[model samples]
Target: MWSRELEGVCDEEYELDCPACGGGLFVAFGSYGTFAAAGDYVGRGAVGEEGRAELAPADPDRLEGVGARLHRAAVGAGRTQVARALTYVFGEGRCPSCDVVFSVREQVEQR
Candidate 1:
Protein backbone atom coordinates (compact mmCIF):
# COMPACT_ATOMS: atom_id res chain seq x y z
CA MET A 1 0.00 0.00 0.00
CA TRP A 2 1.19 3.47 -0.79
CA SER A 3 1.36 5.85 2.12
CA ARG A 4 0.64 9.57 1.72
CA GLU A 5 3.32 10.41 4.26
CA LEU A 6 5.84 8.41 2.29
CA GLU A 7 4.82 10.14 -0.91
CA GLY A 8 5.38 13.53 0.70
CA VAL A 9 8.83 12.60 1.83
CA CYS A 10 9.74 10.96 -1.46
CA ASP A 11 9.28 14.21 -3.34
CA GLU A 12 12.15 15.83 -1.54
CA GLU A 13 15.82 15.58 -2.46
CA TYR A 14 17.93 13.35 -0.21
CA GLU A 15 21.36 11.92 0.37
CA LEU A 16 23.09 8.59 0.20
CA ASP A 17 26.55 7.22 0.86
CA CYS A 18 28.90 6.04 -1.82
CA PRO A 19 29.32 2.34 -1.16
CA ALA A 20 32.95 2.23 -2.23
CA CYS A 21 34.25 5.37 -0.55
CA GLY A 22 31.68 6.03 2.17
CA GLY A 23 31.41 9.63 1.02
CA GLY A 24 28.26 11.64 1.65
CA LEU A 25 26.45 12.15 -1.62
CA PHE A 26 23.58 14.48 -2.32
CA VAL A 27 21.08 12.89 -4.65
CA ALA A 28 19.07 15.59 -6.29
CA PHE A 29 16.87 16.01 -9.36
CA GLY A 30 16.19 19.69 -9.26
CA SER A 31 17.82 22.61 -11.13
CA TYR A 32 21.18 20.94 -10.73
CA GLY A 33 19.81 18.10 -12.84
CA THR A 34 19.72 14.48 -11.74
CA PHE A 35 23.12 13.75 -10.23
CA ALA A 36 24.91 12.47 -7.14
CA ALA A 37 27.51 14.82 -5.76
CA ALA A 38 29.67 15.04 -2.67
CA GLY A 39 29.63 18.84 -2.61
CA ASP A 40 26.93 21.51 -2.50
CA TYR A 41 25.45 21.63 -6.02
CA VAL A 42 22.25 23.55 -5.48
CA GLY A 43 21.36 27.10 -6.58
CA ARG A 44 23.96 29.27 -8.28
CA GLY A 45 26.88 28.00 -6.29
CA ALA A 46 29.76 26.32 -8.06
CA VAL A 47 31.03 22.92 -6.99
CA GLY A 48 34.18 21.03 -7.82
CA GLU A 49 34.07 17.99 -10.07
CA GLU A 50 36.07 15.78 -7.74
CA GLY A 51 33.12 13.79 -6.46
CA ARG A 52 30.36 14.37 -8.94
CA ALA A 53 28.81 11.51 -10.85
CA GLU A 54 25.89 11.70 -13.23
CA LEU A 55 23.04 9.32 -12.44
CA ALA A 56 22.19 6.83 -15.15
CA PRO A 57 18.43 6.43 -15.06
CA ALA A 58 16.88 3.02 -15.51
CA ASP A 59 15.16 2.04 -18.71
CA PRO A 60 11.42 1.80 -18.17
CA ASP A 61 11.13 -1.04 -20.64
CA ARG A 62 13.65 -3.09 -18.67
CA LEU A 63 12.26 -2.45 -15.20
CA GLU A 64 10.70 -5.42 -13.45
CA GLY A 65 8.77 -6.32 -10.31
CA VAL A 66 8.55 -3.57 -7.68
CA GLY A 67 10.53 -1.12 -9.74
CA ALA A 68 8.16 -1.49 -12.68
CA ARG A 69 5.11 -1.26 -10.43
CA LEU A 70 6.29 1.92 -8.71
CA HIS A 71 7.21 3.57 -12.01
CA ARG A 72 3.82 2.77 -13.43
CA ALA A 73 2.05 4.11 -10.37
CA ALA A 74 3.89 7.39 -10.51
CA VAL A 75 3.16 7.76 -14.20
CA GLY A 76 -0.49 6.87 -13.66
CA ALA A 77 -0.71 9.58 -11.00
CA GLY A 78 0.76 12.10 -13.47
CA ARG A 79 3.82 12.61 -11.29
CA THR A 80 6.27 12.51 -14.16
CA GLN A 81 9.08 14.04 -12.16
CA VAL A 82 8.63 11.41 -9.51
CA ALA A 83 8.59 8.79 -12.20
CA ARG A 84 11.86 10.13 -13.54
CA ALA A 85 13.36 10.08 -10.10
CA LEU A 86 12.13 6.55 -9.63
CA THR A 87 14.12 5.57 -12.71
CA TYR A 88 17.22 6.91 -11.05
CA VAL A 89 16.31 5.19 -7.80
CA PHE A 90 16.34 1.85 -9.60
CA GLY A 91 19.29 2.79 -11.77
CA GLU A 92 23.06 2.69 -11.41
CA GLY A 93 25.37 5.23 -9.81
CA ARG A 94 29.12 5.65 -9.94
CA CYS A 95 31.33 6.52 -7.01
CA PRO A 96 33.40 9.49 -8.09
CA SER A 97 36.01 8.78 -5.47
CA CYS A 98 36.50 5.10 -6.16
CA ASP A 99 35.15 5.06 -9.72
CA VAL A 100 33.08 2.06 -8.84
CA VAL A 101 29.67 1.66 -10.40
CA PHE A 102 26.92 0.23 -8.23
CA SER A 103 23.17 -0.23 -8.24
CA VAL A 104 21.55 2.67 -6.44
CA ARG A 105 18.86 0.54 -4.80
CA GLU A 106 21.19 -2.21 -3.69
CA GLN A 107 23.64 0.26 -2.18
CA VAL A 108 20.87 2.03 -0.31
CA GLU A 109 19.60 -1.26 1.05
CA GLN A 110 23.08 -2.21 2.20
CA ARG A 111 23.40 0.86 4.38
Candidate 2:
Protein backbone atom coordinates (compact mmCIF):
# COMPACT_ATOMS: atom_id res chain seq x y z
CA MET A 1 0.00 0.00 0.00
CA TRP A 2 1.21 3.51 -0.74
CA SER A 3 1.40 6.09 2.02
CA ARG A 4 -1.65 8.18 2.67
CA GLU A 5 0.65 11.16 2.94
CA LEU A 6 1.17 10.84 -0.81
CA GLU A 7 -2.37 12.10 -1.16
CA GLY A 8 -1.17 15.41 0.26
CA VAL A 9 -0.23 18.63 -1.48
CA CYS A 10 3.48 17.99 -1.77
CA ASP A 11 3.04 15.94 -4.89
CA GLU A 12 1.71 18.15 -7.63
CA GLU A 13 3.87 17.33 -10.61
CA TYR A 14 4.74 13.95 -12.03
CA GLU A 15 7.10 13.02 -14.83
CA LEU A 16 5.81 10.05 -16.76
CA ASP A 17 6.60 8.46 -20.09
CA CYS A 18 3.93 8.21 -22.71
CA PRO A 19 3.08 4.52 -22.92
CA ALA A 20 2.68 4.68 -26.66
CA CYS A 21 5.40 6.98 -28.00
CA GLY A 22 7.80 6.89 -25.06
CA GLY A 23 7.82 10.67 -25.02
CA GLY A 24 8.40 12.48 -21.76
CA LEU A 25 5.17 13.64 -20.20
CA PHE A 26 4.56 16.21 -17.53
CA VAL A 27 1.52 15.39 -15.45
CA ALA A 28 0.50 18.26 -13.25
CA PHE A 29 -2.46 18.82 -10.92
CA GLY A 30 -2.35 22.28 -9.49
CA SER A 31 -3.00 25.95 -10.31
CA TYR A 32 -2.36 25.29 -14.00
CA GLY A 33 -5.10 22.67 -14.03
CA THR A 34 -5.08 18.90 -14.34
CA PHE A 35 -3.42 17.96 -17.59
CA ALA A 36 -0.55 16.10 -19.20
CA ALA A 37 1.90 17.65 -21.61
CA ALA A 38 4.62 16.34 -23.79
CA GLY A 39 7.99 18.05 -23.22
CA ASP A 40 8.62 21.06 -20.98
CA TYR A 41 5.33 22.50 -19.79
CA VAL A 42 6.31 24.73 -16.93
CA GLY A 43 7.42 28.33 -16.80
CA ARG A 44 8.40 30.74 -19.59
CA GLY A 45 6.73 30.03 -22.91
CA ALA A 46 5.58 26.53 -22.22
CA VAL A 47 4.29 24.35 -25.00
CA GLY A 48 0.96 25.43 -26.42
CA GLU A 49 -2.40 23.64 -26.33
CA GLU A 50 -1.33 21.25 -29.05
CA GLY A 51 1.11 19.54 -26.74
CA ARG A 52 -1.27 19.03 -23.87
CA ALA A 53 -4.09 16.69 -23.05
CA GLU A 54 -6.70 17.26 -20.37
CA LEU A 55 -7.06 14.74 -17.56
CA ALA A 56 -10.37 13.03 -16.92
CA PRO A 57 -10.89 12.59 -13.21
CA ALA A 58 -12.40 9.36 -11.95
CA ASP A 59 -15.90 9.13 -10.56
CA PRO A 60 -15.63 9.16 -6.78
CA ASP A 61 -18.56 6.79 -6.25
CA ARG A 62 -17.12 4.31 -8.70
CA LEU A 63 -13.65 4.27 -7.12
CA GLU A 64 -12.47 0.81 -6.11
CA GLY A 65 -9.53 -0.98 -4.48
CA VAL A 66 -6.57 1.26 -3.73
CA GLY A 67 -8.14 4.29 -5.33
CA ALA A 68 -11.17 3.95 -3.04
CA ARG A 69 -8.99 3.44 0.01
CA LEU A 70 -6.88 6.49 -0.73
CA HIS A 71 -9.91 8.66 -1.38
CA ARG A 72 -11.52 7.52 1.85
CA ALA A 73 -8.38 8.22 3.82
CA ALA A 74 -8.02 11.70 2.36
CA VAL A 75 -11.67 12.54 3.00
CA GLY A 76 -11.44 11.14 6.53
CA ALA A 77 -8.44 13.34 7.23
CA GLY A 78 -10.27 16.34 5.86
CA ARG A 79 -7.83 16.70 3.01
CA THR A 80 -10.40 17.56 0.42
CA GLN A 81 -7.82 18.87 -2.02
CA VAL A 82 -5.87 15.67 -1.76
CA ALA A 83 -8.96 13.62 -2.36
CA ARG A 84 -9.76 15.68 -5.40
CA ALA A 85 -6.25 15.30 -6.73
CA LEU A 86 -6.43 11.55 -6.26
CA THR A 87 -9.38 11.39 -8.57
CA TYR A 88 -7.13 12.75 -11.31
CA VAL A 89 -4.20 10.60 -10.34
CA PHE A 90 -6.31 7.48 -10.56
CA GLY A 91 -8.06 8.54 -13.76
CA GLU A 92 -7.30 8.60 -17.44
CA GLY A 93 -4.68 10.68 -19.25
CA ARG A 94 -4.25 11.00 -22.96
CA CYS A 95 -0.82 11.33 -24.48
CA PRO A 96 -0.67 14.51 -26.49
CA SER A 97 2.18 13.17 -28.55
CA CYS A 98 0.73 9.80 -29.45
CA ASP A 99 -2.91 10.21 -28.63
CA VAL A 100 -2.90 7.13 -26.46
CA VAL A 101 -5.22 7.23 -23.49
CA PHE A 102 -3.67 5.58 -20.48
CA SER A 103 -4.06 5.20 -16.75
CA VAL A 104 -2.21 7.88 -14.81
CA ARG A 105 -1.55 5.56 -11.89
CA GLU A 106 -0.26 2.71 -14.01
CA GLN A 107 2.15 5.01 -15.82
CA VAL A 108 3.47 6.29 -12.53
CA GLU A 109 3.97 2.74 -11.33
CA GLN A 110 5.89 1.89 -14.48
CA ARG A 111 8.44 4.50 -13.56
Candidate 3:
Protein backbone atom coordinates (compact mmCIF):
# COMPACT_ATOMS: atom_id res chain seq x y z
CA MET A 1 0.00 0.00 0.00
CA TRP A 2 1.13 3.60 -0.74
CA SER A 3 0.34 6.83 1.09
CA ARG A 4 0.69 10.52 0.24
CA GLU A 5 -0.39 13.96 1.32
CA LEU A 6 -3.78 15.39 0.38
CA GLU A 7 -4.45 18.93 -0.81
CA GLY A 8 -8.09 19.96 -0.76
CA VAL A 9 -10.89 21.24 1.39
CA CYS A 10 -11.56 18.71 4.10
CA ASP A 11 -14.52 19.25 6.40
CA GLU A 12 -15.22 22.48 4.58
CA GLU A 13 -18.34 24.54 5.30
CA TYR A 14 -19.46 27.35 3.04
CA GLU A 15 -21.53 28.32 0.05
CA LEU A 16 -20.58 28.39 -3.60
CA ASP A 17 -22.20 29.77 -6.70
CA CYS A 18 -24.40 27.56 -8.82
CA PRO A 19 -22.98 27.24 -12.31
CA ALA A 20 -26.43 27.09 -13.82
CA CYS A 21 -28.48 29.44 -11.63
CA GLY A 22 -25.91 31.61 -9.94
CA GLY A 23 -27.48 30.50 -6.71
CA GLY A 24 -25.68 29.99 -3.46
CA LEU A 25 -24.70 26.36 -3.05
CA PHE A 26 -23.87 25.60 0.51
CA VAL A 27 -21.10 23.05 0.76
CA ALA A 28 -19.97 21.37 3.89
CA PHE A 29 -17.26 18.73 3.87
CA GLY A 30 -16.70 16.41 6.76
CA SER A 31 -15.42 13.03 7.83
CA TYR A 32 -17.46 9.98 8.89
CA GLY A 33 -18.72 9.97 5.34
CA THR A 34 -20.80 7.50 3.37
CA PHE A 35 -19.67 5.95 0.09
CA ALA A 36 -21.28 4.04 -2.73
CA ALA A 37 -20.71 0.33 -2.31
CA ALA A 38 -21.52 -2.65 -4.47
CA GLY A 39 -22.81 -5.78 -2.89
CA ASP A 40 -25.08 -8.77 -3.34
CA TYR A 41 -28.01 -9.80 -1.31
CA VAL A 42 -30.10 -12.95 -1.25
CA GLY A 43 -32.99 -12.19 -3.50
CA ARG A 44 -36.44 -13.32 -2.68
CA GLY A 45 -37.37 -16.47 -4.46
CA ALA A 46 -40.48 -16.66 -6.62
CA VAL A 47 -43.12 -19.02 -5.41
CA GLY A 48 -46.20 -20.74 -6.96
CA GLU A 49 -46.34 -22.86 -10.09
CA GLU A 50 -43.66 -20.72 -11.74
CA GLY A 51 -41.20 -22.56 -9.54
CA ARG A 52 -38.40 -20.95 -7.55
CA ALA A 53 -37.03 -17.91 -9.38
CA GLU A 54 -34.76 -15.29 -7.92
CA LEU A 55 -33.85 -11.81 -9.04
CA ALA A 56 -30.71 -9.95 -8.16
CA PRO A 57 -28.70 -7.10 -9.48
CA ALA A 58 -26.07 -8.18 -11.96
CA ASP A 59 -23.74 -5.50 -10.61
CA PRO A 60 -25.25 -2.96 -8.27
CA ASP A 61 -23.08 0.12 -8.19
CA ARG A 62 -23.21 3.87 -7.94
CA LEU A 63 -20.95 6.84 -7.25
CA GLU A 64 -19.89 7.17 -3.68
CA GLY A 65 -20.83 10.14 -1.59
CA VAL A 66 -18.63 13.17 -2.19
CA GLY A 67 -17.09 13.09 1.26
CA ALA A 68 -16.35 9.37 1.09
CA ARG A 69 -14.85 9.60 -2.37
CA LEU A 70 -12.76 12.56 -1.32
CA HIS A 71 -11.57 10.80 1.78
CA ARG A 72 -10.74 7.61 -0.07
CA ALA A 73 -9.08 9.47 -2.89
CA ALA A 74 -7.11 11.54 -0.45
CA VAL A 75 -6.01 8.45 1.38
CA GLY A 76 -5.09 6.77 -1.91
CA ALA A 77 -4.16 9.27 -4.65
CA GLY A 78 -3.25 12.14 -2.33
CA ARG A 79 -3.00 15.47 -4.12
CA THR A 80 -4.13 14.29 -7.53
CA GLN A 81 -7.48 13.04 -6.30
CA VAL A 82 -7.47 15.66 -3.62
CA ALA A 83 -7.27 18.45 -6.18
CA ARG A 84 -10.08 16.99 -8.22
CA ALA A 85 -12.10 16.05 -5.18
CA LEU A 86 -12.04 19.59 -3.86
CA THR A 87 -13.52 20.78 -7.12
CA TYR A 88 -17.08 20.25 -5.79
CA VAL A 89 -16.85 16.55 -6.55
CA PHE A 90 -20.45 15.49 -5.99
CA GLY A 91 -23.79 16.31 -4.43
CA GLU A 92 -27.33 17.39 -5.29
CA GLY A 93 -29.03 20.49 -3.96
CA ARG A 94 -31.66 22.97 -4.85
CA CYS A 95 -30.48 26.40 -5.95
CA PRO A 96 -31.81 29.02 -3.56
CA SER A 97 -31.91 31.51 -6.41
CA CYS A 98 -33.63 29.85 -9.35
CA ASP A 99 -35.15 27.14 -7.17
CA VAL A 100 -33.74 24.47 -9.41
CA VAL A 101 -32.32 21.15 -8.32
CA PHE A 102 -28.75 20.72 -9.45
CA SER A 103 -25.90 18.28 -9.05
CA VAL A 104 -22.35 19.40 -8.48
CA ARG A 105 -19.31 17.84 -10.09
CA GLU A 106 -15.94 18.87 -11.41
CA GLN A 107 -15.04 18.40 -15.05
CA VAL A 108 -11.91 16.55 -16.07
CA GLU A 109 -9.05 18.76 -17.15
CA GLN A 110 -8.00 18.44 -20.76
CA ARG A 111 -4.38 18.41 -21.69
How many clashes (backbone N, Cα, C below 3 Å) per candidate? 0, 0, 2
Q: Write the per-residue lDDT of candidate 2 for residues 1-111, one digit (tens) a residue.
A: 256436333568678899989999988887788899997787898988898999999999999998899889989999998889889888899999889999998887777
Q: What is the lDDT of residue 43 in candidate 3?
A: 43
Q: Cα RMSD to native, each candidate? A: 3.1, 2.1, 15.7
Report the lDDT of model 1 for residue 61. 86
Name the candidate, 1 or 3, with the larger TM-score value.
1
Report the number of backbone clashes for model 2.
Answer: 0
Which segments of candidate 3 are over 4 A away from where they belong? 1-8, 31-60, 64-88, 107-111
| Per-model lDDT | 0.72, 0.85, 0.35
Q: Which residue segments of model 2 deviate by more than 4 Å? A: 4-9
Q: What TM-score, computed on C-alpha atoms, does each candidate reach?
A: 0.78, 0.90, 0.35
Evaluation by lDDT, superior candidate among 2 and 3: 2
Query: What C-alpha lDDT, on a 0 to 100 scale, does residue 78 get in candidate 3?
Result: 57
Model 3 C-alpha lDDT per residue in residues 1-111, reported as the tens digit of each score: 011212224433333455565534343333412211111111464122222111111111244564455545655765643443444434444444454544533311100
RMSD of 1: 3.1
Tens-place lDDT per residue, model 1, 9-40, is 27544567878788877766555577777766
For candidate 2, the TM-score is 0.90
